[model samples]
Target: MDRDKEYRDACNQWLADCMLIYHNQVEKIRKKRLAAATEALTLCIKKQKKCVNETIKETIDFDTSYANKPSSVQMNVPKKVLEDLSFHSYIRMSATQLENLVSLTGPEMQKNNCFKKSIGVAQGLLLTLKFLAAGDSIYTVSCQYSIDCETIENIISTACKAIWNQLVLNVMPSDLSKNRWLKMAQEFEEKWDFPHCIGAIDAVHIVMQPSSNESPSKQKSNERNSIVLLAICDANFIFTFVDMGTYGCNGEIFRASQIGCAFENNDMNLPKPSPLNENDTENFPYVLVGDEAFPLKTYLLRPYPQKDCIEVSRLNFNCRLIRAQKTIETCLGILSSRWQIFSKTINMDVDKTMKIVQACVCLHNWLRLSDLSGNSCVRYMTTELVDQKVGDVFVAGSCRKSSERSGAFKDISCVGSNVGSRKAIQIRDSYLHYFNSNETLTRG
Candidate 1:
């Protein structure tokens, strides 16, 4: 009887403790809910007060203005139909939208109070875009906007650098992973039947004013003098790598060798060439397609000699390469066509010129990402013509085998066979057909 009584007493004590814990938890929850409700009510009251204050201020201002006005005064004025102003028609962006984009770069551009006050972000962006879209010189742009030349230049340079560093580099598709590069290679192969192509390689001559300090030996002939820009572009016509220090008139072969050496030496952070797989048909590893300017290496493919094959085979190869190489050519065309700075002889120092080129390329990539081109047909034509030119150049004589040269030349002389006769005619006819076609139809 005594043991039973003790057990009952312990059970009662346990029940009492459980009730106490539950009561504490309920109290905590209630307090939390009450605090949240108070915060929400306070915010609502604040907002209501602000609205009321604004309404009272507006009412007072209106009353004061009405009290100062003369009630009986009237004057006859000529009626005018004010049509919507077209002055802003060419401006594709509003001041607010441009300011938003510029603000996206970061606080550095926004913090410059003098800059912000002098030129609104919208006006600055419109000026730069006008320079790009219309290919106008800085002088011309300055005249149109009634801005000083130095001010215009400074604005363009600052804005371009900001856009390049923040928007272009930060947002560009990276080629860091091998998996992504391999996927790109596969896409190139599928589209153009060009195997293992990560990108297209080419060179362009950027005309520059004669350097006053250049020695006689450094200058090219009087007819042509400029700096050469060697570049590699990806499928989207975006430059993956660029080399701009070479002088004009350097042989394409020499430039290719330099670039190859740079890759071999790890001078640039280029992907290292891998050994060929056992099953690989072409022993060439890490290849780039180029015109005759490049040598006949395992890593590069040029066109067959003009005399060797039927026209159909040459035409086919040319067409394929043209489609592949179009990216680089289009890159150059866009650079020259959109940026008038490159269209004429650039007078800036070499370092500044290179920076401008890089800035332009970065801008092009950014614009492409934004899909800002309104007219699809015009864009297509611009890209297509560039590809066709690359194809024609590659098909003509770029890919001749070194071993076959001596023997083939002897045989061609003896046989008196027409060189590259088959493919040349087809390409010529196709080019003419393209040239003669209506622009609208061609774009379609």
Candidate 2:
């Protein structure tokens, strides 16, 4: 009976151990199942959060926000602000003129494409003007205009091309009429007192960076990559002709040679040779005065180099040439001061920079015309007044006495002897005699 009791106890213990192992296995399975469910739920939650964020971003109206913001150009710029001098200083145009430009350029700049959301014509022009007047970077303008960098770049380039295509013909009349040339000549004689002088010729350097792809052989020794702006300005500081994009390595004389082809080919329609004085029988060609950098042509007059010039007559010719050449110097000075873009190096690629420069020249003419039309009180400023001051100093030193004047004419025989042709020398001597005879005339 005792043996039977021990066997029964052992069996009971074995059954209890099996039951405990089963419970532990069930717990392990439950934990694994719970962990898988939790991971699935977490992924769903993340997907829902991403979807909600995207929907919110899509619903936000960038244009509407920009319009309502006081920092924006549309709402921030008031109607009265357009007339203010500060506003004009920023855009370089009066309210009326700006309106006209917007009206003129608006249709072309406006987008009709499917992108439906694009910068407007007026806004684009405003952006371009801001860039030109302030010399601001594209990124800066993009931030101010509330546009993307790509959009700002597109707007500026398109607006500049539009301005050039639309208004350049009207502003820069290439085929000027004979009457117009005569009027220019008359103005030169009246203002600068240089007879038969149509304009003053000069050149300025516009600095730029060479392209990365530029061949090593093409690179200049000085490594200066620049565009030469060869221009001729009338007495009133109007650019009559402009040729740009010549390499800076080429000297001014070589650059002038490039522009003189039109005149040589008779395509320029330069005025016919006429007498310097009304009573004089000897005829003189309508001439463009330049510095010693230019070679003396029948139509182009350069000063006798001071190194070779010993006589007072040569000095007098040089003084007169300097007086006329001041117009171009002053024209370029005013251009740089007003635009301010030219004062610093242009950061654009070569092709775009060329277009912008051409546009600036056109706009300069437009503003000058506006100034003459009673639109703005500020006249197109020039350095001619400073030139006049220098002339005052020169007259005080050189033209004070009759003996000094007599001594100048006495040496006239030696003038232009080494430099110019006989005919050219004779023409210069006639002018020298004319200048000497009219000693009472204003030496402007």
Candidate 3:
């Protein structure tokens, strides 16, 4: 009996030992696997980093030989840039203008010491202007400017934010008093012959993604992820108001815009409805002119339908409406043609891209106010479109001839209905009658 009990205890001890050994072996295997997995993950991340920057490398060979070469920056770069007339093709601003911009934005652009020493205010501004004006790839700009890619991007973002903060109020003031609007209305009437017109409204599509971001199926199609720039321009081709960061047709985007929402709520601070002339019986409200894609409203006017143009009065109205709408088109052309950034697909993050856009908008207004076009300004302001004889005679403006914009946001045809309220139609008829009348005057 004693021997039998001892044998059972020995067997139990052996079983326990085996179980312990098994667990120990399992732990060793698991530790190896964990280390291997962590190493693999680290390698994967490194590979992704390289791939991300190299996706478009085949198209343009970047000289990363930058590190081995002498420093890519120079103190005289701004001066050289200003002296090179050809450089204007890359950055459209003049020396004095660029310097003035530096003065306004230099404080904001100032930076503290970091990974790489911060470039000077002027150099950083030059890099930003060149990148924005030409839409050069980040790597390309970095190599050309002798700056790091991340540094350049930060510089651009800072400069743009500075521009917006400094100039948005003075250039494109949203809270313009009634007096300012009256002045804008005066300019429209004198230039476009569309009395009581404050501005021309339109929407432009700016592609926010590169072709690589789209799936293969979508890449082949016309579809791309994009945002709309719903802009209103005065007779002087200055952006008075701009709302963006939406994706849709013009009508949908317009409905979602600030001006459109204000119009819907009847809360905008527009001039009250008044007679077209002292002798006129009906009172006409001040209005904005847009293409047929926009709904005709009491406060907004679009051209008559093609079928309705059978009558001479309707034809004349359409002609005049189209003539005023040219301001929107001209402004878009000038914006795109001069800046050149809107001409290409933007590959950056959406937030940064938006800041750049705001900066560009402010710059456009500044340039117009400063009269950067010099002698060309006189030619640009020359009378282009004339409908004194209606559709029977017309001439394209010098702006249209000079400003064949590259790849700026394009004007799109609206698929939705634009036929508006009875009151809106009545407003259109009143304008139509006023335009056809021989008594119509150019003075607002």
Candidate 4:
């Protein structure tokens, strides 16, 4: 009985200790909760004070007069001053052409606000054009236009986007009809003396400055430091199609491969195959002539490799094909010369750079088709008709030989071996025969 009594007393003592420990834990939790609540309240009060101080400061410093004030600086190029300015010097367009562009893109580019006045559409258009034509940095352009650098950037972006969206449909159609392709083919035959040709395809390296955050390895690579602009131009210097923003590190062959995917996928509405000569019964598809950098496809013709020069016929075929391909090179030269922006390394965001280039192409097409066509800027464009009149055959051949030295020519033999079919070979041979027999080859 005494042992049982001692056990009961011990159990009671253990229970008492457990209750005391539980009470101590509850008190500690209460203190923690109080500290957390106090900290949160203090933070909330601090944020509210900051907000109130900011609001009060903004209200006190707000100047109503500044909102009403006009820009102290204005565009100095007035009508009389513009008259004195050369058409090519002022935005690389005739004044009449500039007016026409303004008419098309004005409504879309105009911005307005109730408190602060926005830039006028006319001023904005001029600013954008001068920026592109001058190839000036945003800060330099902003100073000339009497606007902030940020404002100039906004204007340029908006104007370029507007120009591309508004004019690309009319200038460069994605879905060309059968008649349109036929028209291009006829022009190629008549002007370039090349049959069954619709366009000349090529790519150019648009120089760009490497970003600060780019890796040292990437910056060191030439291709990584530039952009590739792939385009197809017609017998005229107008761009028929453009695919921009490809990485510079990629070769022209890579860009062409992307188009090949579209062609194979039946997404590209290519012209239907027809006769090489009007009298011939066997049909041949219209083809685009590109340099050796591109792979040989049934629809795209590249020259024979340097080692493949076994016969005069092979050499003649390369010459004629290069004659057709020269259109794209001339178009690129004219574009770069006119814009001046393309001649140097473009230091801007990739997207902005693309839009600017796209805008230039649209303007080129517009200028080619516009009534204001007497501008001297277009005289730089190479003309097949002029060369034909002078009986110049060696010019294209010489150009091809010179171009081969640029190291851009790829060994496309392996790639072409699989893709080029027997039928395409026959079509190329037929053209070679036509070129050899039609006219006596003469030196340029």
Candidate 5:
């Protein structure tokens, strides 16, 4: 009986000890998991703090000194010249304002070392604008600014890419509502007496350096050979669409046709047309006005042949076409004359050239917006025209008496009468006026 009791007590004690051991082991595991979790959380917090600190540092750095410094270690452009060239007028943004824009554009340019390093982002951007505005050779720009050609190229590429990808893409309003487009169409009708016109269409050549022998076959086409740029200008003279990559020597009519097809195929961002009917035909139909190079389709209108029996009618159509198409010429003229970079052959690869072109377009829009927002004098001028005398016989036959013209022309007579109810008469008068004005002036 005594041995049995002793053995039983020992077994109970052993069981108790094992249970305690097991509990201790479980507690130890719990502690280890807690420690590991705490360590992981602590490490994450440190990483987050480091990131916050770095961001704050960057913000502070940009806010304090980014705008005042030059883009490179050495200041290549003279301080005075840089100051003078800096857009500082009512039409130009201040340094701080430009810096904010740079900050907004910084992320897109972060991959570029030229943008990431020594130069102020604004200064780098300014250099590129100067290049575009002056149309100077890269070598000449380099010599004038005292920066290496490579650096100038880098700055221009980075700045242009970022501006195009960010500002132009985001800010350019694309609301092509029928009402808006129709309003533009109506403006053409009222101002230039162009019936059922949607917008004025024309192509301008932006000269580029000859393509390399190694250039891809697709890029070596006739239009791409010399770089012809096609653009459709709104009534306000703003370029709504620009298509490049055609050969320079390609006829404007051919290129305009391609663009029209592209618009039909939805290649360009043209708004879709609604169904057509006779009553709405004169108002709702979208049409493109071009010179003799383009065919006469219902959607596309061209001047009547000068040699046709309807010579007066042709003259009228041409005058209206010129009045509307003048916008494209004005836009191109401003681009080439105001921004020098476009007037001369561009040295960069085609891809870079495209970005630069886009950037300039965006910049032009920006300037226009700025100009409109304020009452600045010296708004950019339009294309010049010289007045000349038209043969009286041609004018007399083509121009109908105001009383003889149809009702539609009379209903819009208030606007048309200023020039004249007859299209041929208006054109002849404009030509005469152009010729008499200045010998150097060229018709738009």
Candidate 6:
């Protein structure tokens, strides 16, 4: 009788175990179904929202957001707000400077405007200045200026065009006379102690975000596209010449440029080679200092490679060239710091980007030249940018940090690796000898 009871108890326990396993399997299946349904519902809602957004975007045309004109934007900014330095100095312009910019660009913006309620001249200038001062999008700018994205676009285009047109001549003249070049050389001599150096040449890469239509490879964050800005700056940290809107290798772009051709052909009306001292017989060209990316030529001087700098003369020559080269980099640093647009990648098309860059360059030169007292530019150019003699060593300025934040002030990676001519080597040696022998030049 006891054995029979034990068998019954075992059967009952076995049946309970099977029932618990079945319940667990059913519960798992039910939970999975619920999760799948929730996922499907969320996807449907996302699709609906996407459809609605697309329809709304279709209703609103980007180019015709204002009135009827493609280039006219209705502005709501007050005149007082536009003129107030405290209000608008986010773009780094003084009140006097802002007024001057408005005056320079006002006429072009006011010409042939049929719209009764169009953007005012000061308003347009402020809007454009805001755009150039940072990497904000048109829509983002629209929110701040109380204007539509499309109208903001037109205002930026019109304002940039006017700025470049009005200030190009006074700031960066396309054609400089021989006397002007000589004056530049003299300034270089006095300030940099670099005799016969009229300007410093270098290329700064302007970072660009590739449009969706461009190759997918370029759209990656790591593989960004860039347009090269090849510039020559004088001793006063002003751009003497600017060639922008070029893509590809820096050396190739420079070689294909008009100024580059002038350098090669000796047709830029640059000062003729002359002896620096009365006793010195070797004539030295008024040259532009450049980095290793640029090829050494009679008209341009690049430093000797580090691998070949076994002699003290080569190192000394490199230091002088580097000292002069700081002019261009410092100019770029100030431009980027003030304009602020160069701190981030430009999202516009190449043509539009070119116009913006040109406009900024002109503005940079205008402010630099107008501040005759040098007080107005003091904040932008502190002692951090100037070279100093630290004991026996000649130390470079620590202002490279200022340029590190700029998108357009960084050096190009793709070098030309160009083999310079024999004449170029002889000229470099001559300059090296001249610097090493002169006690005045050698003492830090």
Best by lDDT: 6
| Candidate 4 residue spans exceeding 4 A from truth | 1-73, 78-85, 112-118, 248-258, 371-419, 437-444
RMSD of 3: 14.5
**Global lDDT of each candidate:** 0.50, 0.65, 0.71, 0.66, 0.55, 0.73
Instruction: Candidate 1: list runs displaced more than 4 Å.
Output: 1-101, 106-122, 171-175, 210-225, 252-261, 266-284, 305-319, 338-341, 372-444
Error of 2 at 216 (Å): 7.4
Candidate 5 residue-wise lDDT at 299: 50
Model 6 Cα lDDT, one tens digit per residue, 34-101: 99999997797445334343223222111122322333454444222323445434655665566666
Candidate 3: tens digits of C-alpha lDDT, residues 1-444: 999999999999999999999999999999999999999977974453343433333221111222112233542242233344554555666555666777787666564231126566656677778877777888887787676788877878887888898899989987667788789888887887888898998876666654566577765533245566788999888899998786655557677777788877877678777776678877778899988888888888999889778998888888888888888888776666566677776766667788888988898788777764462222212234212344766555444532443354655576135879999899899898888887763431
Over 50-118, each residue of candidate 2 has an lDDT whose tens digit, in order, gives: 424322322211123122222223312222243246667777776667777866766666542211255
lDDT of 1 by residue, 405-433 (tens): 22101111111112334444443334333
* TM-score of candidate 4 versus the correct structure, residues matched by position: 0.70
Kindly indicate the candidate among 1 and 5 with the higher TM-score: 5
RMSD of each: 23.2, 14.9, 14.5, 17.5, 17.5, 19.1
Question: What is the Cα-based lDDT of residue 64 in candidate 3?
Answer: 23
My TM-score estimates for the predictions, one after another, are 0.53, 0.70, 0.73, 0.70, 0.60, 0.75
Backbone clashes, candidate 2: 0
The model with the greatest TM-score is 6
TM-score of 6: 0.75
Sort the predicted structures by lDDT, highest score first.
Answer: 6, 3, 4, 2, 5, 1
Writing each residue's lDDT as its tens digit, candidate 5 over 1-444 gives 999999999999999999999999999999999999999977974453343432232221232244453344544432221133234432244444455567766666656777556566756666776677666678986777677788878888888888777766543554466676778777776655554567766554444555565567745543453444556666655666666555433433343446656654655343455423343322233666655544454455555557662544445446666666655555555555445565445777677787888887777666565556563333432223111237653222111221121211111101001111354344333333332334313322
Candidate 6 regions exceeding 4 Å error are 1-88, 112-118, 218-224, 373-399, 405-410, 414-417, 438-444
